[model samples]
Target: MWAVRRASHPLRSQGYRLGAFRAASTKSSFGHDVDCGVVVTCVPGRKVHVLDCHSLPLLSAARHGKSVNGGYCLWNRGLSSQAGTESSGEESELDDGFSELENPIADTNLEAKAGEGEIGEGLVSDSELLSDDDNEDDAGENELHLSDAESEESKKKTLSEFLKVIVAAPRMKMDAALDKWIEEGNPLGRYEIHSAMLNLRKRRWFGKALELSEYSESHKLLDFVERDYASRLDLIAKVKGLQKAERYVEKIPESFRGEIIYRTLLANCVVQMNMKKAEEVFNKMRDMDLQMTAFSCNQLLLLYKRLDKKKIADVLLFMEKENLKPTLFTYKLLIDTKGQSNDISGMEQLFETMKAEGMKPDIQVQSKLAKYYIHGGLNEKAEAVLKELEGDNLKVNRGACRALLPLYADLGKADEAEKVWKVCESDPRLAECVAAIEAWGKLGKIKKAEGVFEKMIESWKKGVSSRHYTSLLKVYANHKLLAKGKDLAKRMVDSGCRIGPWTWDALVKLYVDAGEVEKADSILQKAAQQGQTKPLFSSYMTIMDQYAKRGDVHNAEKIFLRLRQSGYVGRIRQYQSLLQAYVSAKAPAYGFRDRMKADNVFPNKAVAAQLAQVDAFRKSALSDLLD
Candidate 1:
């Protein structure tokens, strides 16, 4: 046996290194002369070089025999030295030259494992990891001068740049970026494909996310794992709604129909409020005999909690029968259901049960308790719960702070509200800002509310939403800070904010308080003409109520007529106000009740008493005229 290595070759410079080969004189089955040297072919990214034992013998001979698979054994040190691979973190070991160049042992082992049915679990095909070399020769035969390390570094740079472009590119340019990636002829590595999809998903660019997923599948770049499917399902639910999510599930073959897919479908059902569909999914899982896990049961329980709390008993019984252990989330959900039903005792029992089960209540549970206490008007209990929550940690949760703020506002506990605000003020969320502002505004702390507004403007990355602007405007409107209120209203309009009904009512109240009825009427008229958004019925009601209280019944009737013309059928309260206006003016309102009835609006007790008073007064006036 002889081992041969070529010292110099034109092909070596072209990125192709031919390893040593062996020759034997044994006759073969075909009965031809058997003295030709075996060829060891080495193919790089493109070109291939074939080495013959007789032509190149630059190294010493080594022991040789038939390989395990009955092929002549030959070794290649150069190919063995390479640790480069297509997948991130996975190293591909080069086989001896005796193995076929196209058939690496890594691939063979992967195939063997797949045949044993472990493919989808974690196994990825080499074809997906490595670039397709079947069409390599057809792809122009250019010699790549980059060494292994240099090639890896270049690839890392390319991936990094590609990720940056994808992330920073506008939604409109995402497709172009993907096309550029393909045009660059750089094979996308595993990390590149996964990271790109993840980034697209995070941006909620559903179309681009699906496009990248399809691109990967079409190009055989990476196999779609469970996470990929989950993300795609999430995109479908978010962008295309529940129907599309259902269709997506149908398209998935039965092999991929597992607990993960069902869980995603159930979550979408929850979001879409399709309770029946959620139940159907649970039934399907049972039909498939999929193991009833606590997670699946919990999802089902959430659906039940929203729709019919009585069904929660069924879930508990099912869990007991199935021997599925209940998680902390399950117990917490039960606690919430009890709290919502006002069964405070039941809720407390569940809390005790959770603790007995070694499920410690976290900040979320404490906040829930605080909310329950607030709902029941147990202010002291609510305060105690909040204090316990605060003592638990110096760094309070934003949600907890929001909950505490609202409770403080409702109870008129401004100092406690301020303390909660201070804890979350350093790094506040939009919700936290809104809650703090509202709490201070309710407590009649206009200055503190304004301070929070300024902080909200300065800190939130996305500028304040119209709702935030309107929230602050309410403070200005309530306090009759006419100068500031007028300026802010102009800013809101100039900034293209649709003034909320509360803000509009506040402004009208400010005008009425100032005895500027004409200005208030003009504001309403301007709001009506400004946009397709008609002023809310309450805006007109505010002005009518103001006019009625001032005994300006004619103006009140005019506003009422305008409201009816604007497609607002008067409700009981509005009708009562109108009737009160008639009583103030002593106008005959004989057919008004009939008209209200025609609109399916019945007069309340207050309107009835007003009508009776009018009737008795008319009878008395007639009697006097007869005398």
Candidate 2:
């Protein structure tokens, strides 16, 4: 659409300037200078024309057909040029007509006719201009004003060419081509390349494009296409290309750098394993004088976690120096990382800091702190954290409940553990609590752990299968309740829960712990018959330890030989147990003596000396009994 702005004129009627000009005669009956109002035609097709209507004497003389004035042509020469048909004959005819004019009215009519002819000629020229076919030779010469359809077609052509370049170029070359197009000073080219880059990003080639942009920045070519630099950084981050994303951001003009870009790039770098790059970018950001937001500061905290504790301290010092306040996410990350590293002091300090900052710990943070306390064997602190979060209603997590319940059982805090379990019972995540309860029961919190099992059964409603029953059996075996563990195993099998090697191993370990060798042997036989004795290292160690504890030299020797034959490397403790058993029997054979004397053999020197005392005592007892 063409926009027309009207120009204002002061001397004209209704603020409208007439398109015509007039010239006035200066002297009476003599050639003199004329006062002329010159009107220059501003529109492209028309020409300047002057009218001398105000010269009264000349007007009077021109009223008659004869020219009483000197050298005056009635018709405007400018009109002939406007009509596109300038000729000497037309000028002569105008002069003859001026001689024939009867009055000024005839001259006005003639001027009006010339004006109409000029407009008609302009219309004809425009039609011819539009009709001319485009050719290579005429293309530069013709300044044809584009119609809306033609402009749209040009835009489409530009966009199509740009898309072809983008699609044909490798990902690494796309940004270079885009930057080159933008540098060529074509707005359409800039828009097209920008659009193509956006599409490439959508197709999951954002990383490659980001790399190209970085290369462009290094070459000082990125300045041409920095309009959407922030958005490109965000896109690179969303696609998880942190390094390239950071490079794209570093190339962004200083005026364009803002909190959003800084935070996104910092967060991206925070999770990467490359600490050196992250630190460098972070420091560079600081040097840029950009105020780090809370999110960005938190990202630094996460980045510091992968470094040493001293480095973390340095980061904290830096944060303090920069006046960056730690947010809830920051504290949460610090607490979780410290907890994972078993840094109880560090976790406690972080918790205290949060309290000082008046930031109430959320459930996720509380869960982490509780887990840390539990790991340190500080059940009281763990329970306190849980209870604080749960409050009067005791709304602890099922997993936390399971974890804490076991700790309570170990500490004999059965009531507290039971309360936590009740809260867990109402939660839909009951199955998740099963492992926790079993863990607690195994840690000698049998009764408290049993409470969780009973809740699971009640929640399930129907008779529980062996799959469910085995967890409780495992708890029993863990607490050295061999008899109960075996009975539960049998019940589990009868209830159609297939007993695996783990179940048998648990039972055998429990029996071995209880010194029920005969029962353990029977269970082993049954396990072998069922093909459930998988000869696990721990189970073998348990049986061998049981033989050593009972002072059964012959059986211990037999088991040791069996273990070696079965590819078991007999540990020193097992060998010591054999020595004790032989000394207790008072019948140490030559082979057994030599094996015991072998240095660096099963039992070391210290254990061998202990075994010699046992042998001496056995000999004295035998002599006493004989006397």
Candidate 3:
């Protein structure tokens, strides 16, 4: 093990916005001087493997560079992108598979008060962040500016005392506690204040993080750097809406308003899938002559890949014009996009090109290729990839076990999945156990899945997180094992599992899949009432689609309306689900076309087909004549 050493290097010396509290003499709220020592977490070659998503390193680029996917990326389907946090045990696994890192906020006293729902509701309101009228320059007092260099908060508190102060009351704004901490003779260590904000963000507590940031800025706490500015910008975009973030951006001193700041904004737009805004930001970056990096290009690619695969070629053409060499991530996006379109030949060609360019396919890429091949009915190719992924020794290459299990199960190779599971069954990691449960669930082995979960509970050193529980919850959801799902959910509650959007999404799937759509809808409503965070967009989609499929137009319409009210107004899934509900119910959806146009959403072929089928259940004059 590498021994911890002193990083006595000054914060400003290292170019970080280390704040005014960086002095070693800072006292804690307890009135004791603390060691403002860095943990020296500069471990080389360390990789944070994401266990799951309501978790990117998060599906943060959501299917694309969706929001914070901010941890070190594991091989995502396309390419691994940059993320900085490790996964906490408490995350609920989202459907999208990406690699995440372990939670890095170790042994810190960043505790959350029970039932207060410290994190903000997930994916709230991406609705037009800035309207045509809320012009950029007009944002008034909400603007972000640099803090005063000698802010008093920085003078009073120690790092240890500061963490306790902020986390002591997670539900309320941190401003008062900070004031109280200062009043108590605590010297704010720049390290403590910054670490507190970083930990809160990792915990997915965007509102609290924003509150802390606001406090830091309003009190003139630290001399802000460009990265510090970018971090705050991300927090604002997440908490206050993108428009507010943009408005705040207008006040940023022009010197610091470089590509990183614009790129941060660009990412938020992509997360919300605001293609128009994303493009505008990109164009602005171009106009400013800011240097373009793989990140911005990847962001555009992710957006177009999801919204209009047709526009992907245009993004590629632009990249080519700029002479941008594709990174592994860029290739990952292109290959996945191609595979998704069922252009297997194109996908293969791109894979070859990546090889020709000397970018080796890592495990994640090979895993992704297996997925495409399996989906494409190229079982032989998939098997080859899986075998290659496993390599010679199962123990040495146990990391591939998680990826291999699901892919094998998807191929219906129960024995092969068992073979992979056997390798790790003796001493499995949390991720491996979760994967085994999913693989077994897919293979229809409920007992085996349960058995593994039981074993995981007994063996997992950190205790089974709600994230760990989420894997089995998904299995139960997939098999429509309502009773089992309910039992496990109760077990989770009894075990005091921290519920977030991920768990909420799983519960919705459980109820909806088991023919308990109303119950699922009820859970969602109740969750909305309790959690500071909104439910996932997919959660809304779950209920809406089920309602539509059941021909429950009233409920479907209500959910569709609720979805819009919840700030997920931009997604086409709800619109389609609502239209499909009308069609299924044999009801004419009058003026639906106008509604679509109003929202800037147009009908795709599937939605149009649905519309044609439901457009006139009543005989219109033209249709009557044709008949």
Candidate 4:
């Protein structure tokens, strides 16, 4: 065994750095104030291995003892290397496929609460380690008393907290924050890492996700699970394109290339409408005997259902030959195909066939059936199906309710939509509530829309996301309920709901509709003050267009300047708006045109034609003066 002593110079001081790993520490995972460290051992002749004192060496049998896929109990000991403290049998390993120098703490306290009896009854969990404000007792309560269910909950909470921290911080701070998290002995294991990746994907932040993955690998923690491959492939497809994604899949190790990755790629192809590439991938899957499920086959069927319906029959035949059993999803795809081709009878036959197979039709199937009948103008058939769904002993799902609301809204059946809304009102999902509100809004039933928004807000505090708040603001704006809208906006801000571009536009439009130009300008100014560095281009354009139409060239110019200050410049539309302002103000057009030319923005037909009219007027005035 190599007994390595600390070098005279610290690693952090020696400029030792890796992916997202830098030297900064308030407290190490061991509660010691030391920075992260690694010990390098040089073997005879050629090989050197860097190891963490707290971490087992890569080739060490202890390293393989802790599998990344296995779950471990919480760590009880602190990370301090104080004398007289021994590694406990209860000490858990990092199952995230990472072993780093552990911050070892001295034996402190190990008293469980009134009803705790697990082996790890006094350990600190990954969640506790991550929490900054958590007291010693709070940490103990979480780690010691957690049952299996609570342990799962703790893991989810830990994952959520980690994501929030990374998301809230600036990109520059992300590296330091992540390093600190790992150094604190929190598990950045497979599940946690995948959770983080999914959240990033939801935000379309694939670049950041890839950065995190690189950091994980540098820390020796990256586990290439099937989901991870699929997520990365999807990110590649989105960030690059379908062609790049195809190329990427080809480069993946043959063993790692499987159904999930193929499904993701085929899905991407369907989305991009690259039918030729889709066919190639499908054929490749078939040739490799990898197309074992109807899932992959259905994706291709979806593509053909949109383009060439004749090919869909061939796909169904291929499914039979492959012995890939048709799933409920398969029938759903077939139903959609027939519906698209206006084959109402064929759609009905598929739906009945699905039910005859003992597959209880879910809300999705019911909704599709209703929609098919509705599209065929068979109103009675649509009503019968909807009535059966709503009155069935089986609970009407939010989707079914959602479908009925839109149909009712389209037909101006406010009472019917209200019935559907009542069924969906108990749903915690904001989408269901938003759909009900929109249905009312579509029918010009302002009171009903307001009632839907209010009821949802009152029912579930978590239901009212920023989108819901924006939707309510839009309702108020549309109805010119100025006082109500202002009150709601203030409440929304006070509740700490983020105001997006749509909300900003709605607020501005409300004031503008009330003929309060200065008030609209006031709200825009307030948004800018609140750190809205970049308002929507459309929001700024709306105000400028309104000001120009009113011959308020001064205010229009102010909005134009605001857009430019917000880092939007050299756009033809912006220059055209400013040019229109000059025309309305009856100022010289030549100066504005020259400015446009300087910005390399030539006038479009509309602006050129207006300028031509202005030039003719100027010439006539000069000629009359000379006469």
Compared with the true structure, all predictions reach lDDT values of: 0.55, 0.47, 0.62, 0.55
lDDT of 4 at 235: 60
Clashes of 2: 5
Model 1 has how many clashing residue pairs? 0
Index of the highest-TM-score prediction:
3
Candidate 2 residue pairs that clash: 63-102, 63-103, 65-99, 65-100, 406-440
lDDT of 2 at 272: 37
lDDT of 4 at 403: 59
- lDDT-better candidate, 1 vs 3: 3
Ten residues in a row with the worst lDDT in model 3?
51-60
How do these models rank on TM-score, best leading?
A: 3, 1, 4, 2
Top lDDT hit: 3
TM-score of 3: 0.72
lDDT of 1 at 576: 67
Span of 10 residues, lowest total lDDT, candidate 4: 67-76
> On residues 1-627, what C-alpha lDDT tens digit does candidate 2 reach at each position?
000001122111112111011212112212322111122232333322221212211111111111111111111111211111221122210121112110111112222332232211010111111111211121322377666678667766776776676667675566666567668864432334344444454344555545544544555533432234554565565454666676777677777776545654554454332344555566556666677555554554444333222123233333433445666665665565446545566467656666767888766677667766866778888778767765654452344454455445545565766666667556534544565566566456677567767777677746455546767776776677776777777766676665655566667767876778768767665665564234443455567567766777777787667655543332344455566566566555445445533421323344546556655334566788998
lDDT of residue 248 for candidate 1: 86
TM-score: the better of candidates 3 and 4: 3
